[model samples]
Target chain A: MDTAQVFGALNIIGLFVFAVSGALTALRNDMDIFGVAMIAFVTGVGGGTIRDVLLGSFPVWWIAAPSAVFICLAGAVAATLAQPLIASRLKTLIWADAMGLSVFAVLGAQAALAAEAPAVIAIFMGAVTATFGGVVRDVLLNEPPLILKQDIYATAALIGAGVYVGLMALGLGISPSAVVAALVTFAIRAVAIIFNIPSPKFARPRKTEL
Target chain B: MDTAQVFGALNIIGLFVFAVSGALTALRNDMDIFGVAMIAFVTGVGGGTIRDVLLGSFPVWWIAAPSAVFICLAGAVAATLAQPLIASRLKTLIWADAMGLSVFAVLGAQAALAAEAPAVIAIFMGAVTATFGGVVRDVLLNEPPLILKQDIYATAALIGAGVYVGLMALGLGISPSAVVAALVTFAIRAVAIIFNIPSPKFARPRKTEL
Candidate 1:
């Protein structure tokens, strides 16, 4: 497979996990079925959609394919239907979300490169496409976005993108470059979670000189 | 002014409006003082920040100057201090918002042109920059965005950008072209509000046969 195809596969896999994570979040928040579906849809496509739309991508990347929508639906439905059984065992969802965040970050940077965007732009796109979906999800749930919280979500994605840039600068092949980036992101998120890296709780402003 | 200076002026003016509008939104939503400031900051810069960051225009446009941050702070402070007086004139907020929207749309497009972007991208950028801030505000408020609401807000902005493009195609000078576009946008938005023009709303999905 070409490098693009490899990244495409990773993107699809990431979409699935993001969608599932969104659905499970909705269910936990006690939203209705439509809300669950909406959250899933938004989270799955949110990052890439923002990237493409701003890049002036015609027809939008996801609109060109039924596969994206279909997978999101399947994941949402599965999460919604299986919430009762799976809520008891939360480890799977957490792991899936972490993996998806990594994969999405890698694929996002690759897509930016493929679009012939500048390196700085590619790295920013990677982080935005990786983390903004979860931000939307959390904001919609009335929680502080994961980024604003103490979680290393956006930070992990950014560091991964930096690695990707470094590898490319070294004249490494795209295949190895992408894989290395994804692995770096995955490791950051996993290690952070395992070590109980906690997000800062949303707080009111304290007394200060203004 | 030089071409770049003109673009610079439009950007700062647009940011001013956006910041003020965001503060007003927070006030209307009954947010805390800090919450209001945060909302104002985000709403004022959110859309353009998204546009520039994704486009790799770092350290994003506002980071170049302390002015954008100052404006946001100023707006928030004014709004907070003027809450009683502002509250008494809640009826005027819509007009203020509409005016801000129109100015921002034209400014966004003009900036894109100055940057030598394609006509289509410039047009989209106008709408994106004007609308996305409100979208973030509404989403945070758990309301469907104004864009998806029954109004001609986006349509007005879109037409204004087209007008700007048309003027340029007709070999009009940049100053005249910009003036015409801004006038057109303001007129469209004003007419919509005065005449109560409404866009169609999204309906719930209809049931289908299995």
Candidate 2:
């Protein structure tokens, strides 16, 4: 497959995994089937939609690609059917999320570069694309966002996007650059998951007396 | 003021009040000054930004209008300074929030109509525009979303948007339609607040035995 085809396939994979994760969250929350589908669809598209809007990409990406919506629904259905099997396999789901994060970080940065955004903005968009879907899902479920609470999630995406931008600036081919950057993102997340690293927290001052 | 200028002024008011509400939420959560400002800015712009994105309006509104950023910051600062006074008077803040919600509901539907979206979509966009900012703020703060829990919040926005759209379809002028719709929205919210009406909840089935 050519570069476009490869990236397109990876994007579908990202959408499907994100949808499964969202459906799982909805099921855990005892949401009805319709709510599960809605959450899954939102989680699948939310990040990329946000990135496209920020970059001023018209009509958003998914509008022209109805297949993406179908993929998300398929993921939701699959997850629902496999709920019992997956319930005890949280680690596997986390790993799948890492895959989605890594791929989307590179794709998001590529999109920004295509849109001629500044490198800094591209990197930020990469992190946003990789993380915001989960953020929206958590918010809808009234759970603390894993993006804010987890170790090395958005940070890993940011570093990976930075690496991809640096490589492109150095004249690396797009395919190789994307592969290296995605791998870097996955490695960082994997390490964090394995070591159970804690995210840094800022110290807040105590409430002052009135 | 002409119609554009009148709507412009009301939009600014909406932004300022939303920012104040966000800043208040941040303060209650014991966030630092910078965090307060960030939340205020997000709350001020989040709903409109979402509306613009979904409508494929490029660059979002705030990027072209730097004044909006400054207004949000000003609101944050004002709220921070007046924290004690506002804390003692929650009713006033609620009324101010109602004003913002009413204005935004009309404006959001107007934007969608301008984009030539279907009437149903326009009305839904109106609700999205009025409530998503608070949804975002509550999510960021790990609180239950008022949009989901509060009485007649998004419903008021939806009905108001429907009124505006319906009036416009019947050949009413923009200014008059906007005014009538916003008043209707505000009246609904005010009634809900006064009566302490409860939001409708869907009855969920009990967990099935494994």
* lDDT values, one for every candidate: 0.72, 0.83
Question: Which predicted model would earn the best lDDT?
Answer: 2
Cα TM-score of candidate 1: 0.58
| TM-score to native of every candidate shown | 0.58, 0.60
Lowest lDDT 10-mer window, candidate 2 chain A? A84-93
Question: Candidate 1: DockQ?
Answer: 0.08
Model 2, runs deviating above 4 Å: A1-41, A54-56, A61-134, A144-210, B32-35, B86-93, B205-210
Model 1 ranges with Cα > 4 A deviation: A31-35, A87-94, A139-144, A198-210, B9-210
lDDT of 1 by residue, A1-210 (tens): 788787778888888888998888887788998898889888888888766655556567877787898888888998877777764525766776787788878777777777776776677677767877777877777754544433566668878887897798799989889888899999988887789674322232221311
C-alpha lDDT (0 to 100) for residue B40 of candidate 2: 93
Q: How big is the positional error of residue B1 in model 1, measured in Å on the Cα after superposition?
A: 2.4
Report the lDDT tens digits of candidate 1 across residue range B1-210. Answer: 765676567666666666676776665544544445556766777777666754556445653354666777786776556655543423344565666677677767766776788999988888877777777766655555767753788888888888988898899987777778877888988888788876656875768832
